[model samples]
Target: METNLSATTAAEANPGTARDAAARHGALGTLALMIAHCAGMVDVVALPVWVGTLIGAYRLDPQQAGLLPTLFLAGAVVSSLFFSPRLNRLPSRVAATLGFCVAALVFFGLASTGRYPVMAALHAVAGIAAGCGLSFTHGTFGRSRNPHRLFAIAGLTLGFFAIAFLGITPGVIAVQGGQTLFRIFAGVMGVAAITSALAFPSLRPKRVAATPAEPRFDRAVWFGMAGVACMGLTQAMMFSFVQRIGLDRGFGFSAVTATLIALGFVNLFPAPIAGLLELRIPGRRVVLAGPLVQAALALVIAQSAAFAPYAAASSVLVAVMIFTHTFAFGMLARLDGTGRAVAATPAMLMTGAAIGPVLGGTLVKQYGYGSLGIAAALIAAMAVFCFSRLERRPN
Candidate 1:
C-alpha cells in the first residue's frame, strides 16, 4: 500500500502536463500494444512454418521439432507468472518499454543464431520477453473503461493479420526461407520497442494497487480465470490440429486448406461484433451462447462426412470461439477493476494452447476423430458451465 501510493500520487499530483499527456496517450497506447502483440506473435504463427525449416536444416526428428514451441510457451507461462503481477506495482511506462526492448534484442539474437541448442535457447529467452510484453499489454487492456471494445479491436486486428499471415508467410517462406521470418520478427520487435517507449504513459494510469478500484481477489476473480482457461483449453485442442481432422475426413487437401483459410473471415466479422455487443448485450448471454454454439458445431466439425457441412461447422466453430473469448474477456475486466485476474489472461491462453496439441494428438491417435470431437464438445460444454458462474450484470 505504501509503495503503491508513492508511484500513483506522484502522477496524480502532476495534474496539468501529466494528465494532458496521459489523456492523449489512450489511442496511441492501444495501437502500440496491439502492434506489439502482432509482432510478438511470431511464437504462435511462425512455429509451423519455421518448424519444417528447423527440421530440414538441423536434421531433427518430429519429436525434436516439437520442443521448439514447447520450450517457448514454457518460457512465456513462467515469465508471465513473475512479471504480470508487477504491472500495477511497478512504473507502467518503464515496465512496458523495457519489455519491448528486451524482446527486440532477443529476437535480433534469434535471427543470428545457427546452432540448434543456441537457437532453442534464444527462442526460449525471446518467449520470456514476449510474455512480459503481453502481460503489460493485457494489464493495460484490463484497465480500459471499455475492455470489450478494446479487446474486440485487438481481435479484429488479429483477424486482419491472419489474412496477412496467409498471404505473407507463404511468400516469405518461398522466396527468403524460414530464417527470414525471424528477421521479420526482429523488425517487428524493434518497432514495438520504439512505439511502446513513445506511448507507454497513455496506455494506463499509474493507479495504486491498493486503491478502491482494485480490490482483493474473491470468488468472481477465480471464476473469471477458470472461465478463460477453459475457453483456451477447448479452442486450442481442436483448432491446433483442425487440418488433420479435415484430412482424416477425406476432404481434398485443397478443399480442407480452403475451408481453413475461409475460417479467417469469422475473425474479421463476429469478433468485432462481440466487442460491440459488450455495451449492448449481457455478457453472460454471449458467453453462454458462444460455447453452446461451438459445442453443437464442434460435434459436426469433428465428424461430418459432407464437405459443405464441414465448412459451415468449421466457420461457426471459429465464430463462436472468437465470440466466447471477446465477451468472456470483457466480463473479466468488469469483475476485477484492478486487472489482476485479467493479468492471468495470457497465462491461461498459452498454457491451454501448450496442452491442446498434446492432448488432441493423443486422443486422435488412440480412439479416432470421434473421440477427439467428443472431447472438444465436452470442454466447450465445460466453458459454458464455467462462464455461467460469472456474476451477471445488466447490459
Candidate 2:
C-alpha cells in the first residue's frame, strides 16, 4: 500500500513538472533565437568591414578579397540546404551545440592566420558550421506559437547588435588591424555555442501527416525562396563594397564610418515596425515594393559622389531588406506547415549572397562603381516578378 501511494504521487507531480519545464524552455528559447540570429547574420554588418580589411590590411586585390566572403556564404548555402530537410530526424540541441562549437574553433583559427589560402579554408568551414546551428534556430522559431513575432524580436536583437558592432569594430580594426575582427567573430560564436548547449529548446518538428513522412514544398514556397534570394544578391553585392565606394569617392574614413554607424541606428526600427504592421498591411504588397525601394537606394549610394546623398542612401539600404524580409519570413512560415521552408532560411538568404561579392567585385573592377546600380536595377525587376508570382494566402 505504501509503494502504491508513492507511485501515484509521482505520476500526479509529473504533469506540473512538465508544464514548468515547458515555460522555462519558452523563455530560454526566445533568448537563444536572438543570440543565434546575431551570430549567424553578423555578415550583414561585417561584410564591408571584412572585405575592406582583407583589401586594406592584408593587401589583397578587390576580386581576391571579395572571393573570401563569397566562399563563406557559399558554404552556408550548402550547409543550410543539406540540413533543412533533415531537421525532423536530427537532434536539434546536439546539432546546434556542435555546429556552433565547431564554428567557434574555426573562427579562432582564422584570427591566428593571415594567409589567403588558409583563411579562405577556415571561412568556408566556419560558414558551414554556423549555418547548421542557424537552420535549427529558425526551425525552432517556426514551431513557436507566434513565429512572426518571435522572428521580429530576433530581428530587433540583431539591430542592437549592429549598433555595437559597427560602432566598435571599425575603430578596433583601425588600430589593431584585421585579426581583431576575426577574434570578435570567434568570441561571438563561442557565446552562441554556450547558449545553444545550455538553453536551445527541443520543440517537436511540424507534422505533415498522422504517420511518419517527409513534407513536400509547393510552388509558392519555391517562388518565395527565389525572391528572397534575389534580394539577398542585391544586398550583398552593394554592401560588400560600401566602405570602398565611399573611400574611392574622396569621402574620408571617418565620414564613411559615421555613415555605417548611422546605418545601425536606422536598423533598430524596421523590425518592430514590421511586427506592428503585420496585421494591417498585406505581406504580398510589402514584398512587391521592397525590391524597387532597394534598387533606388543602391543607385544613389553607388552613383553619388556627394557625401550627403551617399550617406543618406547607404544608411537605409539594409533597413529596406530587414523590413521586407520580416514579412516574407512570416508569409513563408504560414505557407509551409512542415516548417522546412522556413528552416531553409539560411539557404534562401545566402544562395545569391554567395554569388554577390565575386560578381560585384568583377563589375566594380571592370566598369567602376556605377555598374552596381545597373546590376541592382536588373535584379530588382527579377525580384519583383518572383514576389508577384507568390500565391496570396490569408494573412
Candidate 3:
C-alpha cells in the first residue's frame, strides 16, 4: 500500500514518469492488452456471423436476430458507463479477471440455450462482464507513454484475431449451428480471464488533489465521443447485414464467406499503417475524411447488385473504421488528461452499435438494402459535424 502511494505520488508529479512506468512493463502489458482487445471487440467480427446464425440456424426473422446482438451491445454500453468512473478505485487485475470469468460462464450458458429469452438474458450478462474488463484494458492503454502506438499495436493484434475468427467461425456455424458459435465466445472470454489474471500490469490512477471543484470533461471530449458513436453506428448497421446482403443478392455462399475472409485480410493493414502515419498526417484530416469514406463504401455495398462491387466494398468497409478510430482514440487520450473520458471507450463505441443491428433490420424490412446507404449518409453528416467541432492538436 505504501509503495502504491509512492508510485502514485511520483506519477502525479511527472506525467512523463507515468508514461515511462507504463512502458516498463511493456511486453507483458502489451500482450495482456492485445488479448483484452480481441476479447472485448469480439463483437466486431462476431456480430455478422452471430446475427446470421440466429436467422439461419435458429429460424428467426431479421429483427429478432438483430435484437440479440443489440441487447449484448446495449448491456456493454450500460456496464461501461457504470465502471469507467470507478476504475481508479478498483484493483485492475482482480476486476478484469472477475469480469471475464463471469462473462465466460455466461457464454458457456449461452452455448447450452436455444430459447430466445434465455439467450437474450445471457448475452446481456456476458456483455456487462466483458465491458467491465474492457474498461480496465482501455484505461490502462490511455495511461501508456505513447497511447496511439500502443493502441495501434493492439489493433494490429485484433486484425490477426479477426482473420482467424472470420475464417473459422462462419464455417463452423454453417455446419454445427449456434451452439458452436456461443462455445467459441465462451472460449474467448475464458482465455481473456486467464491472461488478465496472469499478466495485467499494475495500474494506479494519477492522484488529483482534493478540492471543491467538480471534475468534468471538456466540450471537445464530448464531441470526440459523439463522433466515434456515429461511426460505430454506421459500421454496425452496414456490417451486420453484409453477409446476408451478399447471399440475398444470389452471391454464392462460398463467395460470400470468401469475402468475409478477405475482409479479415484487409483489416490487417489499417492499424499499423495508421500507427506509422501518426506523425506524418494530422489526425483531424483523417477524422474529417473517415465518415465520408465510410458513407461512400456503404453506398457501394448497399446499392451494388453485382457480386464484384458488393465484395469489393464489403471487404474494406471495416478497415476504414479501424484506421480512423485509431486516430480518434489517440486524440481522445490526449484531450482527456484524467483518463476517465477515454475509459468510456466501450460506451462511446457500443452505444451506437447497440442500436445499429436492430435499426438496420427494421430498415431492411421496411424499405430495402438501399435505404442503408441513405442512413449512412445522414449519420456520416452528423459525425462530420461533430468531428469538425474537435479542437486541433499538434503532431
Winning candidate number (lDDT): 3
Q: What does candidate 3's lDDT look like per residue over 95-121, in tens digits?
A: 888888899999999888889899899
The Cα RMSD of model 3 versus the native structure comes to: 2.5
- Candidate 3, superposed: residue stretches over 4 Å from native: 1-7, 13-23, 205-214
Superposition TM-score, candidate 1 onto the true structure:
0.80
TM-score of each: 0.80, 0.92, 0.95
Which candidate comes out best when scored by TM-score?
3
User: What tens-digit string does per-residue lDDT give for candidate 2 at 1-395?
Assistant: 00000112222233112111222235666687689888988888788998888889898888898899998898899999999887655777778888888988999899888888999999899999989998988876665556677788888899899899999999999999888988999999899989887777764333334334544787888999999999999999999999999988999999999999999999999999999999999999999999999999999988998999999999999999999999999998887754678889999999988888989999988999999999999999999999998888655
Error of 1 at 88 (Å): 1.5
Candidate RMSDs in Å, in order, are 5.2, 6.1, 2.5
- Tens-place lDDT digits, model 1, residues 1-395: 00111224444443212222223235666777688666654444444345444554455554455466656666777777787666566666566667767877877777676777987797778778877877877766676556677778877777776666644654565577667767777777788778877765433445554343334667865766766666666665566555556665788666765665676665688778886677788878877777667667767877787899888887556567667777777777766655656666767676765565556556665777667578877787777777777787874
List ranges where model 2 is wrong by over 4 Å.
1-25, 204-210
The model with the greater TM-score, 2 or 3, is 3
